[model samples]
Target: MENSLNTLHTIAFTHRNLPVSEIGNLHIDPNDQKERLTAFQSAMNLEELMFLSTCNRVEFLFVTEDIVDHRFLHEFFNALYPKLSETQRKLFADSAEDYTGIHAVEHLFSVASSVESMVVGEREIITQVRNAFEDCRKMQLTGDTIRLVMRHTIETAKKVYTETNIARRPVSVVSLAYHKLRDLNVPLDSRILIIGAGVTNTNMSRFLRKHGFEQFHVFNRTFEKAEKLANDLNGTAHKLSDLNTFDQGFDVIITCTGAEKHIITKEIYQQLLQGETDRKIVIDIAIPQDLSPEIIAENNVTHISVEVLQEISNANLKERSKEIQHVEQIIKEALYEFDHNHKSRMVELAMRSVPEKVKEIRSNAVENVFHNELASMDSESREVVEKIMGYMEKKYMSMPMLMAKEILLKKR
Candidate 1:
């Protein structure tokens, strides 16, 4: 079991492994996430599979009997995304980075702790990891080992937060969007148009709600989701198609969607500009960008693109470098414990019959030695005799235990 556990593999196509262009192409829609996860499992016969897809990464962590290579990934992507050409499939395989043994544990911990994020110390990544873990479990793709490691990784992430100040500041792109809106001095009474109700805008709304900003008009392709977020935040909800009908102009517009194309184009921007009494601000946090770059260049509309937020996040990073160092040290300690615990679990799993095997062997030896001898002793003497026998049983078990360990070591 330890041998198999030690062979656990984590293959990731992350911001570090792939360029932004490739990463953007890999974004799985929230609706299709589960289907893709299931597809991966069925296609690969994965025993223990975990899929984590985010804006900057697409990672697959799984356990298999034999070690995996790039060829496996080539087939994996070929099955996972059939639209990809052979060249694209091979590119996906070639670009993926794998971590095995203890490095897998370390890498997982780093990711959960937000150490591997494009913008370090963004706490939302922990939530993203948690959601991925839950999704895997819901899909029945995880085995005991994966469950244990994922739970431990989440715990380690919490420890990083509690022990360090790395996540003390608002560092995520969504949170930065909220801060950017605040900095632009949009009045509290300003009508806020929240375009697209995906994770980014959801997070942005939550951040703004925390700061007691509530003048919102939530819109999404799915009106029900928009209504849900709006009702929760004490705002109004509208279908995205109703933008042209919105008689009221907004002082701030935040466009964050999972769509690949621009959701707010020049025409939409023109419609948004109608009836505006004050200067407007727009925060576009989507990958392809919900607002067109041409709209961003328009006069009188202040635009905050994801790139601008990233620059702001980078500027704030200097103040948290010390905390980052502290977190790396914490991750090292957590990795040591994870490896040790995993080894212990593997041993227990592998030697599950050892105790019973020893018990049977010891009982046979004791019966031969004391079956007749103890029958003639008094009751009190019998009790004392059994105590002595128990001590001898433990002593004898040690020899077998050592031999068993040798066998296990040889297997390793």
Candidate 2:
């Protein structure tokens, strides 16, 4: 099992090498994940697996003994994304970055800490990591290895965020969008048209509401979802279909959805404009943006896309970069701690049967070895003898484990 621990691996396709646009192509739909990941794990003979996807990254963390060379990667992507063309499969396989053993552990800590994120200071990645683990765990796709690693990973991330200046100021896409909106001098009474009820849209809408912008109309494919977000913001809810018929003008449209193509088409924009010639604000933070490119090219719209936010993120990252050394120090300490903890757990597992074994020995001695002698003794003498032996047995059972743990701690 210790050798198996060294086989832990991570395969990452992130914004560092791949464009965010291409990253979306790797996103396995939630409905397809269980079947896809399970089959892939079985085929690869993986001991455990966890899949994590974000706007700009897709990662596969697993424990397997097979060397993840080019051939392995080709086979990996081939089995996992069978629908992809040979060319596409090869492209992904070639672009993938992999790490093994302790390096893989370090990569996860960096990711959850947000230091490896496209937006380095954003703390949302921590929650994203935790949620991803939970989702994978629910599918029974993970085991003790991932569970132990994630526990340490989350702890290191929290320490990094709290102890250092990494997440000092808000630099998330949502916060950046809000800052852009604030700079635009948009009024609180401006009609805010929210175009999805997903996590991104919910956060943006609630953020806007918290900043005293009240006028909102949320639209989602699921009316109940839109209604839920609407209720939270003291706003109105509408089905996504109603967007075509919405005659009410919107000064700002904030849209983020799971649509493969543009949710807000050119015609939808024209109808939504209500003949107003004034400039409009559209925060299209969705990957493969919710706003149509034609709308941005043709209409008088101030579009805030993910790419635009990334440019700002790069500049803000310099300030956060100063704290990387500090964060790395914490991660190093955590890595050492995890080593010690893992060894201690191994000791506990190895000695788990000691008490039962000791009890069996005591039973044999009392019933078989000393049965004749005890039969010749009085009841009071026998009772006292049994109590003394039980005391010794208990101490004998606990001594080895306690001594082992003490030695391990001393070595640490």
Compare the candidates by lDDT and give the number of the best one: 2
Worst 10 residues of 1 by lDDT: 403-412
Cα lDDT tens digits, model 1, 128-235, are: 888988888987888888887887899999999898888886478776777777777766777789888877788888788878777999999899999999987899
Candidate that would win on TM-score: 2
Candidate 2 stretches greater than 4 Å from native: 265-279, 292-300, 360-396, 399-412
Q: Clash number for model 1?
A: 0
Over 149-251, each residue of candidate 2 has an lDDT whose tens digit, in order, gives: 9999999999998899889876887898899899999999999999989777898899999999999999998899999999999999999999999999999
* Clash count of each predicted structure: 0, 0
Quote the lDDT for 274 in model 2.
Answer: 86
| Candidate 1, residue 23: lDDT | 61
